[model samples]
Target: MKSSLRLLSALGLSLCITTLSAKELTVYTYSSFTSSWGPGPQLKTLFEAQCDCTLNYVSSDDGVSLLNRLRLEGASTRADVVLGLDDALMEQTRALGLVQPHQLELSNWPLNPDLAWTDTDFIPFDYGYFAFIYDAHKIETPVDSLEALLNSDASIIYQDPRTSTPGQGLMLWMQKVYGDDVQQAWQRLARNTVTVTKGWSEAYGMFLQGEADYVLSYTTSPAYHVVAEESDQYQAALFTEGHVAQIELAAVTAPSQNVELAQAFLSFLLSEDAQTVIPTTNWMLPVRTDIELPEVFLQTQPQRIGFSPEETEAGRETWLRTWRNAVSR
Candidate 1:
């Protein structure tokens, strides 16, 4: 009888462990998205409560870092879902064949009409327009256009194009505005550039410290200050040339063991519950058009202009080369 009892106990323990392991869902995303302040905690709770599964978030430093991590891990990645890559990386990510089709019917889902999203492999959760943010108190008159910002001798801090998405957006912005004279434009802008940081946080932090007149960031960036700090001092300068839009996306890994669960999370990201949590937490506009946004979003709508994913991918290397040579001089 004693031997039988011990055997039963060991079997029960093994069963419990197996059950727990079966229900876990792993997601790889950026550090900020999974931080205490970001949506990861709340989303994890919400997802786990509904699905009876443990949601795990493995984080990298930023969006670019997430992409790099996947490249290193390849088909051996444990991630079921990969989140936080932007449209700028869509073509590249697709080319790598790392992610599988989400299999969600996004048609008539109340997504932003401006997006015109039709990708089968990835889903857009949020988006924001790239703009130069400045303190209203310091700059009584902000540059009205990209041409003005690049032409003026106003000391500016921006991220490195090779390293950061905002920097890439500005590179695309410069190309859109300057066309054939983009190299000359880069040289002119380099003359007054306070310094180029490796990432958005460093450049924006330096700008907040009054190190530069403007910092390249999302138009929705000022909404963070308005909602969180109750100070409306920071604002994104609306350029006459329009702004480039960055749509943050989520995808299921090709090697996912839990394809159904991964697809559920992608669908959840587009759901009303998740959409409501994204804006304030991520500091970007929800992709859903039907959801009500903060007043700040209503007030600061900038016209969107940008290259398609194909165009971005094709031109990126040449553009980076041009940026490097122009800025170095």
Candidate 2:
């Protein structure tokens, strides 16, 4: 009886060890990334087949909020990977040392060099230009530039600069357009706003509901309507002053015990399968030039407007203050 009991104990211990080895990778990301329409579901399905591990997503409001939450969690963070931050937030994120450097070789991947790859920590996954999306059916004449957006009486919906990436992009884009007079520009633009939301999804939803004439959204947003809904009524207005290109990124956390698994997933992000999933799902441009984009992508005349990591880090607080002061008027 004693020998049989000891044998059962050994078998139970082996089973426990086997179960513990089945890794569950925790990914912290923006809500949009894990949305039904986003590439998250498809990508998760694809990666899981090869990984022999389950992916667990803990989605936050947006990229900034994700980073803020990580900061709060610090060394005790459960996130093995984070997949929504943009280049604008790179410097700040790197400074915190919240994530480990992505050790992947870019030359071996489908990585785009035009993303202006600067940080060794954040890996570029997808990108798009910030633009005012308007339903062509609603407005006869869309605003052509930031100057027109400010001068016209068209009601717009935008995210708040404090909480949203697009909102941050607008503030920075305005800085590029108006130079030292950005505050005056915001004051003028604020009069045209219907309401400010905390994130991109909320602002875009209001526009879609006809609550506003235009929305602060990506140039690629129309591609979703063009391809999936088979509708061409929505379009991004070309701007003379230019649009800010936002490159969304992914990074592995330093505190994660599943580093190899997290890194493997990061590698999978650059795969052709993942790149193919981005355009219509995330409504963003794939980093790989190999994928054939939907024809609606032709409508997006994206202008490059980005800040270096150091430059963004330095002026972030001052720019947010300017945005606050302008909107208050």
Candidate 3:
């Protein structure tokens, strides 16, 4: 009878270990999640509960840096999945062959059916328009357009595109607006500049701390200031030319050993619950059309602007060179 009891106990322990092992998955993303208000922990908890897999996050301060790391790690990368890459870096990600096609079960997703990538190389999770966030109290006539920023007296803060994703978005925004004459646009913008930071957090933090009157950030930036920071002074400007919209995407890494689990996580990210959480925490508009936006978002709807990823990829180097020249001049 004692021998039988020992065998049962061993079997139970084995099952527990197997369960624990099956309940873990690794994800890599941008480092915005380290904050209390960030979406990392909440997403992890929800995904784990639904999929029975624990999410292990590895994050970096910039999306480009994260992609670079994935390239460096190659097939031996510890991450099963990667998130937070925007359309700007899609070419680099694809060229590096860092990610593989994920056939997610996305029946309930309310994405723009025409806009969704047919190849399934990456799935867009959330998106928002890039704009300048400024203190309303400081400036009497706030810069209302991209051109206004170039012509404004108020100091401007922005991130360096080579090192930051928002910076890339802003650069791409200029390219979209200025087109072939982008060099001239940068020349004009450089004249009214304060200085560039390394990332969005630094630029936005400095703006909030009164270091600059205006900082380049997302349209939803003011949402956080209004709701969480409770600062009525901050507001995101609406550019007459329209702001550049960046779509954040997630994908299963090519090296992932557990492709099915990674695909399940990707599908979950597009679900209604996850989409609902995106606007509040990540300060991004949901890609899932069915998700009801918060009251704050309803009041400040971001203007939609379009740009070709191919155009951005082709012109990025030239644009940056022109911007550098403009800044130096």
* Top lDDT hit: 1
Model 1, 1-329: lDDT tens per residue? 22332332323212222222348889999877897878999988876765678889998766777888898899999999999888988889889988998776676367888889999999999999999999999889899997798778899999887667778888999988887889999999998899998777788889999999999999999999999999999999998878899999999998998876676667667877788898998899998887888899888887878899999999989999999999888
The better candidate by lDDT, 2 or 3, is: 2
Judge candidate 3 against the unseen true structure and give its global Cα lDDT, from 0 to 1.
Answer: 0.76
Using all chains and alpha carbons, the TM-scores for the candidates as numbered come to 0.90, 0.92, 0.87
In Å, residue 158's CA in model 3 sits off its true spot by 0.5
Q: Return the lDDT, model 2, position 106.
A: 62
Model 1 Cα RMSD, 1 decimal: 8.2
Worst 10 residues of 1 by lDDT: 11-20
Give candidate 1's TM-score. 0.90
In candidate 2, list every pair of residues with a backbone clash.
none
lDDT of each model, Cα atoms only?
Answer: 0.83, 0.82, 0.76
Q: Which one wins by TM-score: 1 or 3?
A: 1
Candidates ranked, most accurate by lDDT first: 1, 2, 3
Pick by TM-score: which candidate is best?
2
Of 2 and 3, the candidate ahead on TM-score is 2
Report the CA-based lDDT of candidate 1 relative to the real structure.
Answer: 0.83
In candidate 2, how many Å is residue 158 off?
A: 0.4
lDDT of 3 by residue, 71-100 (tens): 889989999989988888887788778999
Task: List clash counts for every candidate, in order.
Answer: 0, 0, 1
